[model samples]
Target: MVSRPHLPEDRMLVEQLRLQLGNIGSSVIPTILLALLLVWVISNDSNAFAMRAWCGITILFKLYLAWDARRLLASEISPERARRLLRRKMVINAIDGATWGSLAWAALGTTTVAGSVLVVAVLAGVAGSSMSSLAPILPVFIVFGAAELVVLGAKLWLMGDPAYDALAVAAVLYTAALLGQARNASRAARRAIGLRFENLELIERLRVETEHAQAAHRAADEANLAKSRFLAAASHDLRQPIHAQGLFLEVLARSQLSADQHDALANARATWQASAEMLDTLLDFSRIEAGVVEPQMQVFPLQPLLNKIENELAPQADAKGIVYRSRETHAAVRSDPALVALILRNLVSNAIRYTEQGGVLVACRARGEQVLLEVWDTGIGIEPAQHQAIFREFHQLGNAERDRRKGLGLGLAIAQGLARALGQPLSLVSTPGRGSVFRVALPAARAGVVAEGAADAMPGPSRAFDLRVLVIDDDESVRTGMRQLLGAWGCVCDLADSIEEAQALARAHRPALVISDYRLRELRTGAEAIAALRAEYGADLPALLITGDTAPQRLREARATGVPLLHKPVLPSQLHRAMSAVLMGRELDSSFAGLEARRA
Candidate 1:
């Protein structure tokens, strides 16, 4: 056993007394019975009184040992008082051993042979039981056992018989055995205590680690929530000015201008459009992550989807001197078409962006009940190691200079996310310097499955802009910008800041269509104003509500009103198209209806 000097002296002594407490009752009972037996077996001679007196003293000493063991068990066992307890218990046990040794002297004075043997055997029994009781405190048990055994040997030597001498030698061997047993038990007790302390330390460590992990998890969740709130607030505030600017820019585009100013304004508009597209792309990604883009899964033709991607990305490919091809197929698939289109668009855009000389191809092949749509590019083929890494956000290849024209390295990542959300298989196959093929497998539509069509959000026929429009916005800048743009489009505009003002304006000169900011004065929403105006004017009064909030809950609340929702900064053209639709008593196109899903 390993020596544990680090074990406190008082702790060891206290624990030993505790063990003695349990053994006290049993140990005392057997010894008491033996005392009575010894008295009965002794001779009734003159020395008989002496023997009985000694027995009485021995029984009294044994009782005192019992009392001490019980006291130690019941007491608080403070360290300062422990030394006194240790001495008291050891002294009592030692005196009891001497009392028991006197039994050998009493047994020798016995008249009959059986009486002497019985008395000696009783003393031997007492020594063995004492060994067990004092096992935790070996030094004390050793002292008592030695005293009893040595006195027995001395008393036996005086008996003068050779056989009696041999019995004395046997007593010596028994004492050695008792001492050995005490040592082994003490070692075992200390080892058990060591293990207990070790276990406690280990348990404490695990508890600390678990607490740290929980705290870190909570911090991360709080940080993510904070980030979402900030983005939502910033998106709203930033878009208000941007929306007003876009309207003013459109008004500027309509007026007569010199050739130089026209070219400059055209460049400015192009730049603005690019920035807006990036914002929309980022917002779309955020919406999907926020669980706001609940896909309306259905069967849609692969050909129409491919043609859309081709038409959208062809101009970019042509500008890059790359041939773009999409093979027509009646292959239909069961999935969300918008999400699928989004996935394909990113893939095609990435393919064109990466390729310098070669062309891009879009084709579908049957794979059992599914169709694998592949976007192949002859540009720079990806390395085998980078095939998976390329799909991670902000990871790029061969663009160490960080060119903006090549995009922000989110195309493949968004594509990967969308494909995973749709539960479709998207894989990449490539060999460096040859080509790369991005493949996605969609469930093939059954023979009788009818695909759903969507209403396009595209603007049509701007000549029908002679309707009376009411614009409600808390911001003066937004109201002025709206007035200028609508006036340029030849529409009469009435403006207000609150629902009451809007109502009064409408009552005086009723608006043919209502245009309002989503968040109006006094914490009232545009949906409420639109409803109040329709109630006062007519049930068929057309209305449009615009918001700049990207918060998922805000978007969901806006959609809950069954109004076609548009996020700011809304381009003037988009507002015009929505006005044209709403004035005709129609919501946005079927396509945007699913995309926006707020149209009643």
Candidate 2:
């Protein structure tokens, strides 16, 4: 057997004592019974009383040893105490062994040869059986067996017969063999005990590690939740001013201004548009997470959608001095056009943003029953390892400084999410330095599916509505801006900052259209205000809910209201279209619906 380092002295002493004492009871009864049998076998009439006396003394010593074992077992075994008890046990066992050995001296000459042989046989049987019980503490077993064997050998050597002298030498040899066996047995027992301690140590270490891992997991979850809360709060607070500014900008654009003033207004508007786009991306993600983005599946020609994306994002590529091209295709496809447009827009924009000198290409290819809408770009291409990570929210490549101009690292994430919601497949192939291709597998227009008309038509100039519009908002700036903007469109505006005021205004003016901010004062939502106004007016009253909340739960709550919802920082054009749709008693203009789908 391979050997291990010895156990600590204290633990080894305690364990040895426990094993030695546990086996003592079994040995005691057997030893006393054998003593009585020896007396019957070897005692003649004259020595019978002396033999019975020796037997009595042996029983007394054995009983004392058994009582000592029981006492030690009941006591707490410290290292020092265990050492003392073990020594006492070994001394007692030595005395008992010598007493049994004395029986050989007394019986050999006094009894018949047959009876003498029985005595030898009994001693050998006792020594052989003791290896199992006595071997845990090797010194105890050695002292006991040696005391008996030495006494027997010495007494037999004193006999004159050659046969008796031979028996003495045989006793010496038997002693060597028994001690060897006991040593092996003791080593095995100690090794087994050591292994048990090792296993217990291992189990304890694992338990500690598992506890640490669970704590880390909990910490990560809490951090993520905290981040979500912060983003929601920040998105809402930031959007209020931007939304107010956009309205004021539209109102300003209607007034007379110098050429340079117009240029500055244009720059301000562009900056506002940038902020609005980033916030919109966040809203899109929240909507997808809330499971509010349901794809409006229909067969539509792919060319119009591709053309629109090119028209919108082509300026960005031109600004970067890179050619942006699209391969025209007449092929039709079945999917949510708004969502697909969002996906393609993100891909095209990303390609332009990353590419320094090379152009981006958008194209479509037939793949059996699916059409692979591919975006090819000669950008600072992605590494193969980062292919999946780029689609994760807030993960960016080559933008460690986090330049906001490059975009919030959410475009690909929003694209991937919308694709999954539509049950379409999106994939990427890239080389580290050359270029990349992002493919979105859209189901081809199937047989028997009627295709929707995909044509671009411009809305005519806005005419005076001559309608009374009630605007509800908590912010003073927002309320003022809404009033001015509405007045610009030739509509009479009644503004209220609270639900009570909004209801009062509704009753007083009998508004033709209701426009309310989603979140209001007193922790009451705009949905509640809309409900109150609708209750005051009639269910047929047209209403629009505008909110800046990007929280997933807020998105879900707003969507559940069944009132047409528009996010804050809504451009004048988008707001007009939504109001027009409501006023005309039509489903929101396809543009507004498309905007809503992108938000989803």
Candidate 3:
């Protein structure tokens, strides 16, 4: 029976049944105490000594049952195996009960009326308790109870004296009553055990159901993650040529043309830039949700970031006649300045985008050890119920037709995610007609020159006239496009499809600035290519990496290289700014942690 495979569900029931058996076995220690009482009352004689030996052995057997019951309960004992142990215990109980019956006969000579009564009472108690303990196996209980009664009743009837004669008749009647009590106790015990096992089965069923539900949820999450990864991989490949096309358009812009041709080219550039922005938005959302946005936390003043945001978005605000204002504060904050700027940018942009006529105000104030940075705008305010809905991806207010001009409804969601990543809280307060105030609470840093930037040493627009720039990109069209763009800028340019080819060109020309695409052919990278070129020429090589990759690992790797980066589809102005910064060896945006680290 023990060799049979135990069902997983049955293990709990079996363990509980074993526990019940132990409780029933442990309860019998009181019988040992009762037997001790009998020993104290009986006289010290040869007959008494015989009863003492019998009682001592019986007490030892009862202690053995208690010891064995604990050992079984301590482990996972199968029901079939446990029942076998139960049978062994019942055998011991039968022998113990029979011993009690012989005691009355053993002490017949020395036994007084009171002594015999004590002995009979102890025997009856042990028999009754055993009946309840072994109730599940009625045959065992019958064996134990019958042994006690027949031995004691026969001994009493055989004495054949006047007092003994009446007592023997009473003994028979007493045994009958005790047997009835045992039967009742047995039924009650069986009913209670049945209910306990039923409850255990119900609990087991619920546990299995919960595990299945959890497994399904995990599978669904994994599928979503896979889709995000595929989009990231595809974005890198798509951006390369579009980036080249944008650079080619910049070259065309520098060319002299009629007003009509120039206007047509400008419109084409706008469409290309818009496409790049849309792709970038999707990439940013995926990176943030995938937990790839690692913030470069630093102690930086709020004013510089705020000023840059206002200056950058001023045109958009101006076009709508919405007054965009910034309240300057000399407050320094300990946070990722880039991320904080991103959060505020989203809030201000949303305010301006939703508003038809009213202005927007960005204010920073110190509150205790924290700074409350807020963007308050008199826009088309959100309804109370739709406040939370606005922060969800692709969720918009009043854009039922899904107009692309209003932008994807992911700006607030990205802001919220970035705030949480920075260990700050972002909240919104708004009314239907009043306006909305988007706020971020950040830890304030000690005000000092640590937030200040050093003066740039670059000789402005009047610097050097003769500059050679080397461009290495694996994409042929991008390489051709960059060569044309740089030639149009009146700079000596060297273009190549690989580092080896670029190195061959570098040896002949020894170009001053290196511009390389982040990902190259044969699993090589722009950073690696730049490092090798710099090793041969000069370690202080001014280089910039252009990439369209948005995978978290790849982004971190590019950042680690400490080379300035520009995402693909770079406009002519952005390209020139990055170039000027790289040549002069300082970031144009000095407020960012990247340039500050380079300076340090």
Candidate 4:
């Protein structure tokens, strides 16, 4: 009694049974044809009726097996049912093998040696061909082969001849070889099925992980957008009061005060300046992240920019008792000059802040078609591992205490952002306990493309103006503060809180300059107010837009007006410079050139 195969894997058992049974139908016609051929070859006149009857029985058995296979395959088979079906199939296969084996005895008993040879050949062919379909269940193949070989071997041995006995032994050995091959084929099929299942499991796992990653990415983007909206709202509210205070303080400074009073006033002003600078840094970062900072590319001489940076920042280095020098370069570069200047200014200011004793050098040298603009500083140099970290917003080196005077850690971050926006590469080379060099690679302009001109310098002093100025703002304190500041500067001022009011004032006074807040009451923008005033006075009338909005949409909208925009909490001197630029029809001063660059 041969044991049934123990396939513990339920899926594998079902798959094996399905494969074995599915192939049963194709073998039916071939089996019937082979059986008829065998009868023709073995039948004599005396054995003709018996051979024909055996052929009919074999044909009936093949048709029955094929019908049974179709019944099993037509429905979904469970593992337990497959096991039971496997047992029945083994018994059926044994009957099939034995039926073919019966031909062996019938052929040898009545026919010649050629008939026996033909029967043996047919048996060997059937046994070998059945392995592919039956071998998945090793026990079925074993029993099937055993039953056929047992019958043929018994018939051969009972012939009472040495040649027949040897043939019986050969048949037994051949059956063993077929069984061994069947075991290997079963294992190969099992391995292939198992690998297929494992791959499906791995693919499912990857699909789940990918969905989780995509969900996380979308969540992060929404959170970032929310943060930007909150920052813009808070900054605008904060700037209103701060802007009012700065103007009031400037007006207060021009008054006569005792020595101690003057000292206290100066301290208060310095504190206000620090807060304003921090807000400005945040504004710069917000604008870059909002994708609102547009670069105005142009070809310009490098010497004037270098000279300007030295003139502007050398004092800070001098205050620290550290020498500041910028090497003159006639090499011209094609880039956004204002943005490039901002990048260099940040680098120079950062260098000046860090260096305690040695000088900071601003140098530029040509390398092929590019110019390497370098800021060399003899400061507390950075470690190699932290080179990339320093460019991240608010990431500081050696400023663990976050000293406000050392400056917010956004300078380098802003520089890197602006450099990327301009498509220039900014890189750093540093060694711990030594100096560091920050280099910007700018594309050099073609020869004769750069036209040299005197750079726009900040106005020398606050010049008194006899012109009439229209100031529009919804905030009352802001209006009062502006009125006081402009009155001190000898300007006739007309203030309004709405566009209708501003137009009414412009009609009465016909102001020379129109200064308006970007956001006003009744959902009116200062750009609209400025346009109304320009319509009243003339299109050529000078106009300036002041806003504290850090929101990307508002920033972009304000910039599209082609008007000079200044952020709130503006220093008195910055306000003076902007007014002078708008009056003279020259470029606005560097104080708000970043905003002016947006319009360009």
The best candidate by TM-score is: 2
- Residue by residue across 387-504, what tens digits does model 3's lDDT show? 8888887788889998998888878998898898898999999988878999999999875645344221122342322689999988889989988877777788889889999899
- The superposed Cα distance between candidate 1 and the true structure at residue 551, in angstroms, equals 2.4
TM-scores, all models, native as reference: 0.78, 0.84, 0.71, 0.81
> Distance (Å) between predicted and true CA of 504, model 2?
2.7
Clashes of each: 4, 1, 0, 0
Residues 1-600 of candidate 2: C-alpha lDDT, one tens digit per residue:
966556797788798788888888988878887888888767888678778888898889879878888988898899877777777878877887787787777777778889878878877777777667889888888888888898888888887879989988898898789999999999988888788777777799899999999999999989977887889999999999999999999999999999999999999988888788888888777787778888777788888887888887898899889999999997788887778888888888889988988899999999899999999999788987898899988998888999888888988998899999989989999987888999999999876454544333334456667899999899999999998988988999999999899888887889999899999999999899888877877899998999999887888898888888888788777678778878888765321343732322
1 or 3: which has the higher TM-score? 1
lDDT of 1 at 35: 76
Q: What is every candidate's alpha-carbon RMSD to the true fold?
A: 5.2, 4.3, 7.3, 5.3
Error of 4 at 43 (Å): 6.4
Model with the higher lDDT, candidate 1 or 2: 2
Candidate 4 worst ten-residue window by lDDT: 591-600
Which segments of candidate 3 are over 4 A away from where they belong? 1-118, 128-143, 154-221, 283-341, 352-371, 376-403, 417-424, 430-436, 442-465, 587-600
Ranking by TM-score: 2, 4, 1, 3
- Per-residue error at 202 for model 1, in Å? 1.5
Q: Rate the local accuracy (lDDT) of all candidates.
A: 0.78, 0.83, 0.74, 0.84
